[model samples]
Target: MNDYAQYEKDCEAIRTTNQQLLTEFSAWLKTAGLAAGTIKNHCSNIAFYVNEFLLYEEAIEAKDGFTEVDAFLGYWFIKKAMWSSQASIKSNAASLKKFYTFLYEKGLIDKQALADLKEDIKDGMPLWLATLARYEDPDEEDVW
Candidate 1:
């Protein structure tokens, strides 16, 4: 096939894949009994990850770069928030990780990507504590 033809075919394949992903996501949301507003929120979160992080990485950082599942956890949850309080950050990370796991299981991305990403985050809390303890006395509950 000609180069133009090959490019067209590739574009078509990607469109089809995206359509399927959207359909599956909607079904999953329904089966999970998610409310419409919550489903919208989840879709927005996914779009944010794709547009802000994944697309930026692909466009500027590396031509072949796709989504880094771990980055979703770190960036969306840990970095995108107004506050970095431990409890909120942990909760956000858990939610984002769950979304990534869903995408992985759906075959939208490689499972190892999510697994390795989560593995990298295994020491997140402890690492944060090591840094926090450097400046604050952990013995005092009201210090922070």
Candidate 2:
């Protein structure tokens, strides 16, 4: 296969394992009493992180993903996703935080790292929003 096709195949292989964790994450959300729509959104958002961003990688642990989370929220999601805004960014970060919590509770991630990730989200929101704004620029500044 060609490069893109090969990459697609690799991503699919990774998702096969990641999907099991997602199922567990969904169950946890239900037990926590989240609405069905909210659960679906969380699962979908995390699936994007796992299936897209974590592609062609060996390790699939939460500890290895914090930097990926930063890139996803700070850049890729803003440029590629239709829902690009402060609220959407916050929502995505929240989804990832919940997912990481699930991983932590499952003993898949370091507790301290998870706590740090939460703080990073709280601290990084403004910067993420500014980066998104820069990405959305329509060249208005050059019109003068």
Candidate 3:
């Protein structure tokens, strides 16, 4: 197969794996006693992160996505998601934290990686919210 063909194949496999992971994550959330609506929202946020943003440019597995949270929330999500707002940004960050913690407990990621992801979310949230404000500002001269 050609390179592009291989890329497509890889992406399909990743999507399938991500779907299963999401199912497992949802079940895990339920075991933790999260409300149904909260579980749904977390799964939805993670689904978009892994399936859409991760796969947008390459076949990035959810296991490898911890590193991309900064870029995703700091720019891509703010610009791409029509529902982007301060509240949504914070919500997504919380969802990601929960999802990654679940992944860590399942041994999909190491402790250090989980810690780093949490730290990145904590530190980057301010900038991500600021970016959202600028992106949504009608009067901001340089939104990008």
Candidate 4:
């Protein structure tokens, strides 16, 4: 197969794996006593992150997605997701933290990786929110 075909096959495999992980994550959320609606929201958020954003340009596995959170929240999500807003960004951040924590608990990621992901979310939230503000501002000179 050619490179593009190989990329497609790889992405399909990752997506298949992601579905099982999401199912387990959903159950974990339930065990934590989260409301059904909240669990649904979190699972949806993670599905978008792992399935769409992670697969958009490359077949990035969900376990490897901690490193992409910065770009996803700070730029790509704002530009790409039609539902992008302050509330949604905050919601997604929370979901990501929870998902990474789950991965860490399952030994899919190291402690340092989880720590770094949390730190990035904490440090980048203000800027990410500001970027959304600018992107949504009609009169902003440069929205890019």
Q: Number of the top candidate by TM-score? A: 4
Where is model 2 poorest over a 10-residue stretch in terms of lDDT? 54-63
Candidate 1 per-residue C-alpha lDDT over 43-140 given as tens digits, one digit per residue, 9 for 90 to 100: 55554444455444232111122335445444443445455456644543554565666677776558677766566557555554343443245465
- In candidate 3, which residue ranges exceed 4 Å CA deviation? none
Reference-based lDDT, residue 92, model 2: 91
Instruction: Report the Cα RMSD per candidate.
Output: 8.3, 3.8, 0.9, 0.7
Q: Give the TM-score of candidate 3.
A: 0.97
Residue-by-residue lDDT tens digits, candidate 3, 1-144: 998898899999999999999999999999999999999999999999999999998889999999999999999998899998899889999999999999999999999999999999999988888888888889998875
> Which of the predicted structures, 2 or 3, would earn the higher TM-score when compared with the native?
3
Model 2, global lDDT: 0.79
TM-score of each: 0.49, 0.82, 0.97, 0.98
lDDT of 2 by residue, 16-108 (tens): 778898999999999999999999999998887887666634334434686577767887788778877888898899999999999889887
Which one is best on lDDT? 4
Give the per-residue lDDT digits (tens) of candidate 4, residues 98-140. 9999999999999999999999999999999998999998999
lDDT of 2 at 94: 90
88: Cα error in model 3, Å: 1.0
As for candidate 2, its clashing pairs are none
Candidate 1 has which clashing residue pairs, if any?
none
Instruction: Please report the TM-score between candidate 1 and the true structure.
Output: 0.49
